[model samples]
Target: MANPTTPTASVTCSALSYQWPDGTSVFDGLSLSVGRGRVGLVGANGSGKSTLLRLLAGRLRPSQGSVTIGGGLAYLPQNITLDTTPRVDQALGIAERRAALRAIETGDVREEHFETVGDDWDVEERALATLGSLGLGDVELDRTVGRMSGGETVLLCLAALLLERPDVLLLDEPTNNLDLVARRRLCEAVDSWRSGVLIVVSHDRDLLERVDRIAELRSGSVTWYGGGWSAYEEALAIQQEAAGRTLRAAEADVRRQKRELEETQIKVARRQRHNKKMDAQRRAPRIVAGERKRSAQESAGKLRGLHEERLDEARERREEAADAIRDDAEIRVSLPHTAVPAGRTVLSLRELRPRFGRLLRGDLHVHGPERVALVGRNGSGKTTLLRTLTGELEPLSGEARTFVPLRFLPQRLDVLDDELSVAANVARLAPGITDNHIRSQLARFLFKGARAEQPAGTLSGGERFRAALAATMLATPAPQLLMLDEPTNNLDTASVRQLTSALGSYQGALLIASHDLPFLESAGITRWLLLAEELQETTAEEVRDLLEAAAAG
Candidate 1:
């Protein structure tokens, strides 16, 4: 269903349409209204969730139709980059107020200073409280943003937005690069949303679970579901189940109609033969027999027409019922060459300290087809360790060795050459592999025929990921050891599901670094190693328990 109509809607769009200059349409004749509650907007990668949010936030004017807003709106985009030279207060849009207060304390009672400060004397206090609310309590207001971590910068951007107290707030993938603790803090912010219309475009389940309702964007339309992520999922399951039943019934009707049509045709043919025989046997007058034949033919034609119409209607129903099913297709590929022996060592690390991040002295050995998870805070060196293992960054002190063919899919997904087609990129990685063979393997990664020939730069987020994975897996002497760093960082739910399915088809040792515990657990991780000053083994249950305890505390 579309969002409920109400005068309380803080943000609304009517018959909106947006198209790029290149004539690629993102939305067409779409209408939606978001009122005073937390609405979680979600969809597949290219389903226009972000575009819709932008349109509502007034960052992009509608190419056609109208956009209506009840009050001030603030937006936090997916990628936030603040200049490092600016102090926290300056970045928060309160530098002038704070400086004016300082100047007033120094005995300069200028009118402009009072004008800048206004009557809001507690702006500093409010700013600090906002920062602390997002778990940046120690970050001094005078400090430059360069001193902050990436996650802290994200929180800082959010803090600036929250300071506005806008009537409508829009966040797009707010937790894309946050650590576990930062994500929790964001979740808390979401939980405490009571001010105005808070609409978030995110696939973070934790954040999504905090919303009052879910708005799914698909096929240039908005579908609203009450409650949070779990409720929406349950409702979807029911709908799919009902759709399946309807589709089966439609199929059965099509079959029955076809059979009836055949029966009618047979009966008509038999009657025609019988009438012809009667006309011949009786030797009736030519006019009498002709009239009877004409009547019978007309009756047969009407009966045939009726049956054909019924069959056509049944087929149309079948087509519509089929359309109700989802289009999330899974990738299935066999890679027997990727399997590692039970007793073989795939990697060995000793006293390995990378130049980047905080990974201290470490000694670890990975054997067999073990799927190991690297879990830690944002600045805790998960990516550093992965890079160190890949020898992309040399360890500061010791040896990091890989004994098998390896592949690393980084968070940036820079493995593919942007100028080349997906097939060409795969061929570049696997030099000796034939073009047909490369294309054939690419098909299994869900890039079939023309898709495989498409340039990597033109693909959407999920398609680009698939193309990168295809290039990695289809390489010569298949990757026996695979490493993925924050693989699900910005992926939507559907893309995440597709990634899970793709990983299921691989037979290799894995070392994945992510704060997404649910995805890691679903990856069938054989071991969970929390990275800190050292690596410590843990279980999925223990990890969940720790997260729960953290939440409770």
Candidate 2:
């Protein structure tokens, strides 16, 4: 049952308009209202999900309308900006406590009792408790944020938000960097949330399935579907089918109207010719001849006007049909492949060992053409092993070698240059390629036209990944081996399918470290590398048993 007395929050927009500094309108007359409970926000890139979140959080004012959020709200932006030098405990506890004290001094907290308990030690204990609930209990509070992995940092931010206990929580792509275990932890946290409204924006279907309802945003409008991810998908299919039928009907109407206009034109021409012939044959008075000529001109003028009117109507209908079709077009991605033949030995690791502050050990060995998956808990060294293989991190006492040319895509796409435009980045990576070639390559990855010229820093998470792939794969000779770290983290379903298809068809070897179960299953992994206290190789059946055991626990 749902909790009562959670302030029923309502949001509405009337004639709302928003424009960027460059006068590009993002939303015009867009209005939406969300009540209580978990709501998933779905949209394509640049559909203004973030903008709407800000509006609901009262951080951004609408250009022409008022937005009312009637409760205490906490917002988690998609990209969190943190001071990496601060220790985790200071970042979450000490700093927050100091801020709370300052707020009390400034009269921000009206209750005298809150100011009285300003120095209470229980506050820090509560912060620790919240962190534990989010599965970060094992994390060292004294560790710097810079030393943590992307997934760990994101989890810490979520823990901080949960500790605040706001009346509403807005999370944007909260699970993007998390592994399977951490993602499950977040799901559990969201499910257990009570007395608050939660609005989440994500491309994760599994996470969306846990929400109470789904709200789809397309072309600056919100459509609500009662139920979870499956319901949203069904609704989208129905809409696409209806849009297709409308387009077909409009096309047929346009053809019929064009034919009718052509016939009317022919009739008018024949009538003029007949009148002219009759005038030439008749020895009629000047008055009668003048009246006939005037009548003929008047009739021609009215018929021409009517023909143009019909053509205009037909053009409008055709445009409407085109608009509808455009909305339903699926995102398309094309991953370029190189003709590198499979090598005899894909990757070789000898006595590889990675240590964690002298407390933990990870050792492993892997070989060629093996679809190996590394599984472990959140803090384990699964990613560390991959880094060692790529030489990003040196192994403590072992040798790792790849016989073939290798390409690596990191979890965060740090390979991309944020200051450069997308085209420039691609061009820099493939210097031998021409500007036209670079543009064509990026177009396959769905960055075309003006977007191709946009700075890389401005792209969404999915677009950034596409740009990275285009820059990496389109070189003169592509790498024989591909290593991807959580490549599907922020990608939509369509993009993921494209990548999987591309990888499956490539003749070379791939070593992917990901927690995306569906993707791994579809890719047909032949072997698995389980990373617990140490690295162990096993068959697919053994891997499944291990996963089941973990789940049962």
The prediction achieving the highest TM-score against the true structure is: 1
Residue ranges of candidate 2 with Cα displaced over 4 Å: 1-4, 11-16, 58-64, 81-133, 136-160, 281-294, 326-337, 354-375, 449-451, 494-507, 522-527, 538-552
What value of lDDT does candidate 2 attain over all alpha carbons?
0.73
lDDT of each: 0.88, 0.73
Tens-place lDDT digits, model 1, residues 50-103: 878787777888899888887777899987878999999988999999999999
Q: Each model's TM-score, in the order given? A: 0.95, 0.81
For residues 398-487, what per-residue lDDT tens digits would candidate 2 score against the true structure? 678887777787877887899999999888877787899788867766677989998998887667877887676665456667778878
Locate the minimum summed-lDDT window of 10 residues in model 1.
1-10
Best by the lDDT measure: 1
